[model samples]
Target chain A: MSGISLSTTSYRNVSIVLFTLLVVTLVLAELHLGPLAWVAALVIACAKTVLVAVYFMHLRFATPLTRVFALAGVVWYVILLGLTLGDVLTRAH
Target chain B: MTHLAIAPQFDDAAQQHESAALGMWAFLATEVLFFGGLLTVYTVYRMAHPAAFAEASSHLYTWIGAVNTVVLLLSSWTMALAVHAGAHGERARIIRMLAATMALGLAFLLLKAVEYYLDFHDHLVPGRAFRPDWSTNAPAAQMFFILYFILTGMHAAHMLVGVLVVACFVAVIRTTPSPARHANALELVGLYWHFVDIVWIFLFPLLYLVA
Candidate 1:
């Protein structure tokens, strides 16, 4: 917790291992699963994305401002998806 | 404590690193907005015609999509290693990892080309050649293919730019000794690469799975 601590080993280890687990889960879901396949895939995809950001991109080690920048994108994702779909879905057309 | 060729405007190397990182993050945030617009259109259309979109999505090859996902993941890991190596001033390791990342990026592009060819040959390419199932609302399904080509095409273009940027970053490190202080720029580029990976991560599920 001093000058620019870089936990490369731990981060990289988790990333590679998670990559394997993610692929296995993906293939299995593709093989089975009914209407839930898409849901499973989306969840897995989000997990993979988080691992890349926190570990691979080293955002876990980044400063608070940097983390804020990253989270802002997600905020936009919510607003964009929520607003556009909310308006369209609620209206009776 | 090494002398860094920091820009005159920057007070010190650490300040420079922070500024660069923040600037890159700001740019990435804008990219989210850029891509978000397309996603909104995509969602609206899909919401309006769920079954047709699902039908169009089924035509995609999930196995190939999985292959590309793994390829990009490996590239991202290598890119991460390159950033780590850069931090320690391990020049050779940096080169090796960056080269490996570049190689994987090229592999992803090649596989994508093959997939596109298959799409075209299967009559799945949007425009005139698009041959949707006759039973489905062919026009609405065509909309899916239209969005597919646009989304994936833009993503591929970003990957191409990333590959070039990594190549140049490698060349820069090779030419410059003690790239010690500039480690953050490499990390910033790594962030860009990972962001691209995230885009494809979401795209894979949205485009490849239908149920």
Candidate 2:
């Protein structure tokens, strides 16, 4: 999985690996891991999103402009989280 | 005949494919913001009443949410393969994969229906008739359920659209049957399918696991 594997994965293998990862994380995320459960779940979700974006969406072979457009979602999302959450988290009750 | 597949508006196949992909990403960008707004709301409300949000979240059926997550991710995988086949012009492969993706989407929706039914029975749905074991925090809990239903309902609506889109993609492939020339179609559908999956990727933990 260098630079998204260059479309190297077959569908069956890709599905199986991804499904297994999801199941394992789901089962694990259910336990009482304190705040860690939340953290772990978020991390797993990010990883899963990356897997789908890079592999399933074929961003590996995408042009730089296209990749920029694709990444714009993630980048802009962080901005959304940053600005709004910063305001919310910091404001007085 | 094969050359006519390249629309008159496009000079060549590759450029057409690139343009199509770029357009899809641009669309997905807006979709991200659309869902992002809801999620931002989620964050704000949760921060305001973390305990009540957590309580309401716990009332959610973890099993149902977990299973749905699996279903959607698997569907994305299937769509990936279908797109792979489409890129190479494998008609049978494209049909099979697309069918699998659509069926998985349907299965996800079916499970969602079951969850909604059970939540309603449990009085987890917010309305005048709302009731929950955590009645003391009922107001904040009700707020949680409101966002819950709205977000997941919106998500389910998107999934329904995904199913129909896959169905249409199947029809397109059947008519064109030229893998190399029609590669853009496959790629575009795969992108949309995965975008839906990505949305769930964020929603699952926020709604289900964080509690």
Candidate 3:
């Protein structure tokens, strides 16, 4: 919970909370939400992704090289989205 | 014995752990790009045929997808625990958690198999000869199904790989002499497993959340 070095007890504790959130978010996103479902879904998904990265992937205590590589994918993905959406959204006949 | 003997380049336990973690991250980054290509196709098609995209997306089995998401989320938690056990040099705990994660992953695959069976039976599979009573826009709908199968199918393949990887980790735990040397294996496999879950995180919304 506190740092890069994760303990099994910590993992188990975090698992319970994260999983409960996963279920709750899925139910809420599926049932009541309509157009805004994706927003909720993305937020929950981001939370889960961060948890896995920081804990299981060891990115919390990873070296500078590792962090750079991890962030590179994210930065590149964002750039991909920006460029693609820019092309699609900004284009006109 | 060979695995227990020593890795050539790694000097100490910490170096081995760092290298393995970093190596797995690099592999996952490439995986991100691999999935990125398919996601690009999805974005383009969704843009081109918004109505049909919405229609096709509406036909997905939302409950099944949601359940599988929960399953994977739980499995990832187990995976994180397995890594924790490894870091603490608790070999038995590592084995137990790894096995649990692998079983959950297999359960996810079985559920996905059922979903595909329904797809085929429903004629939801994309093809020129396809027939569906749900919508007249069969072509676009078929394309969506195609993308769905390809994307999720590829993901399932990755899950299978994760399962095998976890199984291997279990075996290593049984046979490897220096458990300390191989603690990094747990972290490496955990990295891959988490990446698989993260992909599904995005997939759940893309496939099932359309209104």
Give me the TM-scores of chain B across the candidates: 0.95, 0.94, 0.92
Model 1 misplaced regions, further than 4 Å: A1-4, A24-28, A31-35, B1-4, B133-135
The residue-level lDDT of candidate 2 at B21 comes to 87
The parts of candidate 2 lying over 4 Å away from their true place are A1-10, B1-4, B177-180
The candidates score, on chain A by TM-score, as follows 0.76, 0.81, 0.83
lDDT of 2 by residue, A1-93 (tens): 112234536656666767777776777765778777777877877887777787788787788998999989878988999999889888887
- Candidate 2 is scored at a TM of 0.91
Clashing pairs in 3: none
Question: Which has the better DockQ: candidate 1, or candidate 3?
Answer: 1
lDDT of 1 by residue, A1-82 (tens): 1135556686668777767766666775658576577667777777887887787766776779879988897898789899
Candidate that would win on DockQ: 1
Clashing pairs for model 2 are B89-B179
- Candidate rank order under DockQ: 1, 2, 3
What overall lDDT goes with each candidate model? Answer: 0.81, 0.82, 0.79
Candidate 3 overall Cα lDDT vs. reference?
0.79
Model 2: per-residue lDDT, tens digit, B1-211? 1232678898876677778889999999999989998999988888788888888888898889888988887788788878767666688888899999999999999999999999999988888779877656888899889999999999999999989989988887777746556666667878888998989888988998766
> DockQ for each candidate?
0.55, 0.54, 0.51
Candidates' TM-scores?
A: 0.91, 0.91, 0.90
**Distance from true location, Cα of B98 in model 3, Å:** 1.5
Name model 3 segments beyond 4 Å from true. A1-4, A31-34, B1-8
